[model samples]
Target chain A: MELVGISKLNADYEAAMAVRKGIKLFIDESAKENFKKAGIEVAGTKVEMISDSQIVIDATPDGIGAKNKALYVSMKKPAIFQGGEDADVAEASFSALCNYDEAKGKNYVRVVSCNTTGMLRVICTLKNSFKVRKIRAVLIRRAADPREVKKGPINSILLNPVELPSHHAVDIKTVLKDLDILTMAYVVPTTLMHVHALTVQVDGNPSKEEIINALESSRRILGISKDSKIASTAEIVETFRDMGRIRYDVPEVVFFEDSIHSSNGEIFLTYAVHQESIVVPENIDAVRAMSGLKEKEESISLTDSTLGLLRGRLV
Target chain B: MELVGISKLNADYEAAMAVRKGIKLFIDESAKENFKKAGIEVAGTKVEMISDSQIVIDATPDGIGAKNKALYVSMKKPAIFQGGEDADVAEASFSALCNYDEAKGKNYVRVVSCNTTGMLRVICTLKNSFKVRKIRAVLIRRAADPREVKKGPINSILLNPVELPSHHAVDIKTVLKDLDILTMAYVVPTTLMHVHALTVQVDGNPSKEEIINALESSRRILGISKDSKIASTAEIVETFRDMGRIRYDVPEVVFFEDSIHSSNGEIFLTYAVHQESIVVPENIDAVRAMSGLKEKEESISLTDSTLGLLRGRLV
Candidate 1:
């Protein structure tokens, strides 16, 4: 896979350089020396990369990727944009769980944001088994990635929009077009994981056991820490380390099994999603999906298997 | 106010005796020597504590409190039992926010359990704001008190009832008889606080701003960490410490402001209740109510004011 090394911010540049091994990264002439010093193999401009490659994954910082649309369209190559890009910027949105069928052979795909992706995974999984009426979620979001020190209030809690449903609900609509959801979001100071408190109302009042069984049987939805020992999200992060995951990336929604409660035909639960790698599996699925190389099931299974999804306490 | 501490477990005895400067304590003959060495004052027997007091607060173990019912009735002394006691054992169940008037002048009063107390506090506060149709909650419970090391699985998640709706729902019924609530409980290995994921469905679809306004206006619900810098419960605890709270105890439910979401007439949010001090103000209110010392508002205001509830980020 080729990378895009834009010598913009310190963090983005360093991130690209760190993962530059065995991949040809597109960079400007000014960043060639820095790339060489960092032992990174450099390629040509974004135009050249688009022309040479069969498909392009636009990971450039938000608006920049969307602005490069004309280049990809001129080359007639399939393009995949990161979640940061606007949904309208892409031809259609893709989540491995929600819209996998529609994603196949797509020329352009915008993978949903991390929170939307996590919610979609659970909602899509459960909607097949139960009659989902509505979804209400409160997102306890991390302020920034661990390395993004320059990107936070550092000590204050600020509400995005400070009113109404946050943009997350609107963003999710790009994938699950018909699903009714209302989301509230808050960015906390910590850079650990995003915790979501979700309430999903189904048609009939099911037993708690039934809800747990359904959620547990779902794909990529991990029922974690049912035992009394593993307590907080902090302990969960430690558990991920114990499992020896690459970069301690848990690519699934870590939900508390005992917290899955069904009453009056409604389900209430809490889950923590590791924001860093939650999108990695979906990105892999999108690649196969856009290339039309594999069917939905085959692509998901291959991606999950390659990412060690079924190996341990994770889904 | 006099405290009647009974010497039983080593920790309980030490706790009681350490604070026995002006208080009377009841102890068995076997533990009398330990109390004497600890420079604690020992009163007559359990019978004497029940006989001499204007109101006997039964702090005994669960079933034991019910077992001592005859002694309290024989003396015609009004008694208050902790939540561990059976609800039927008391003349009326009491929570500061719910049925405080009914609790007054009752000979036997049973305060709701910690989980029930916390739930009642929120439910009673919100019931009037909107016509609450149903409440679905997932209780992330603490395994034991911080000092009670021998009382937990230590590293295992244990589900109480292992089925739909734990005893908390039943207990809450003791207070809010008409409330439609379903609660599932799990004991995690942490003693910090009990976090609840709550979903409330009301009559007409209220706006997110309406819900936030209702909750913020309610008593003893602290909207904490409005800034991104104050992140997790750990940092919230640190904030409490910085505020110079006694033992860093936050008597109210600390909820993230940005996480309050309302859609389709349903509200979703998460809040952490400090288990240790959650009931402290209630106990004070209960005492005043039972003694006929003050009206409900007077008692609650006095209790809140005396506990420094109004001075900090709470109440």
Candidate 2:
């Protein structure tokens, strides 16, 4: 499959593609000078590129994804909407670990948000090995991405919804219908990563080693011990940079191995989710599932391998 | 009682007392020019100030308080140490609501940290009305005070202690011995306030109204609803500024009434603790208790009233 990029904002489009490769790119002329300076040529706008693409990833800002749905539908192309879109805009609210089956061969699949994706991976990993009963999570959210200077909470903490069972839990339920979960979130003045304090209550007692082993076995979960000198989100990003990850993107959940505590059928742990990239692998897997190109495990493996999520320090 | 300020650093000493009045002062010449510009005169260093003082509030930086303990003892003066010092530095880790009796007439009393002071108010308030069996708190801590430019976690979240039962729970246990509590903390890039997601499990089921009324009756707990337009820490700080609070200090715990959730004998709620100011009233009450000036109820009332925490929008 060939990859194509389209955007009205040339600068944003150029910045995005500069980190990776895209064939047949289309963007406005706003960034033409910068592209010239960098010895890169730009292809002007092309609305007709949709006709050649099998699946479209509608990652436009929040509400715009819903508006773009009509264009994709008219072209008879499958599209994967982002978490920002309304759940009804797609066939399923997707998490590769939770509902790959539901998104398989579907016209549209909405990959859940960063926090939800991170929680689902842990819950699903445990559910596969135990009778998971209930879950409670406190999401310490980053105020904005490092590049979004216009965003804030610059010196404060915000209760985004100012209520219990923040929308994250509701969004997760859309993908894992029968799972019991509750979430609380506080938006802090940090642009790096989100930290989740999760408690999973199961039916019977599970040893800490068993739970740790299960989480370790998951390709998308990166466990780092306290002694590893990678304690905070800052260190995690630096580690990714040291490993030569483009844009210092950490696609896997950074689970603190020392934080794992289990007793009386309850498991408690803390993990950091790189909001910018945790959903990338899920988005790639969604495309594969929706296009009927591969089965669940195979699609996940392929996506993980392509993203280098299954190799090096991430493993 | 006369108040005297003493600091080796004149700038910090001047900054602290400029907001209030002190009969005698001591500091270096670092802030002499600024003090002159403000029409304020700074007295030279006075190491002998402790001789005439009955009770000294040793607000020195963390370990410094423990070291200063020697001087206080040498002068035979009663002193109040801050949370930074270990619990052993004082007669009791003092929380006015938790163990005022233990600190009364003591030579030294250590008021707990801002987060601990905030949590103890809520937990103690609930424990007064219910049999608080266990408590689990997730402390979303501010990275530093707004003035501490050198402190950071500027773009990342640091899991302080990177372990369970962060020192906060251990500190609380020092005062309320035999109380079952567990706390987790993450330091985020915010200098305004610390937000806590607290879960209190009691013996018998209590109605939401009962819990709300119990919290509302506490002088140190200020309840704000979601519709009150004081949802986040930024709004809370802005409101305090509009209220004409000195340095925008909020000495009370700003409890989000809308975040209160009660079910199956468990009470869940979220609150914001202004890190710079939440410990102020606690320090005042510690002074009264340490100097044997007033009983718990009377001292708390005096401190709350003097700090204006009992008036205006706070009520």
Candidate with maximal DockQ: 2
Off by over 4 Å in 2: A4-22, A27-47, A311-315, B4-22, B27-47, B311-315
Please write out the lDDT profile of model 2 over residues B20-97, one tens digit for every residue: 565456554465576566655556544556765678888878898998888789878888888889999987888888
What TM-score against the true chain A does chain A of each candidate get?
A: 0.90, 0.91
User: Of the candidates shown, which would achieve the greatest lDDT relative to the real structure?
Assistant: 2
Report the C-alpha lDDT of model 2 over A1-315, residue by residue, as the tens digit: 457655544445445565356545655446566656655545654355676578888777889899988888887898999888888999888999878889877898899988889989888988889999988889988888988879987878888777677999899899888877888888888888999999888998988778778888887988886678677888988888888998998889888887777878877889999999999999998988888889999999988888888422342
Query: Candidate 2's error at A251, in angstroms?
Result: 1.0
Local distance difference test, each candidate: 0.72, 0.81
Residue-level error in angstroms, candidate 2, position B264:
2.4
Models 1 onward score TM values of 0.71, 0.91
Residue A222 CA displacement from its true place in model 1, Å: 6.0
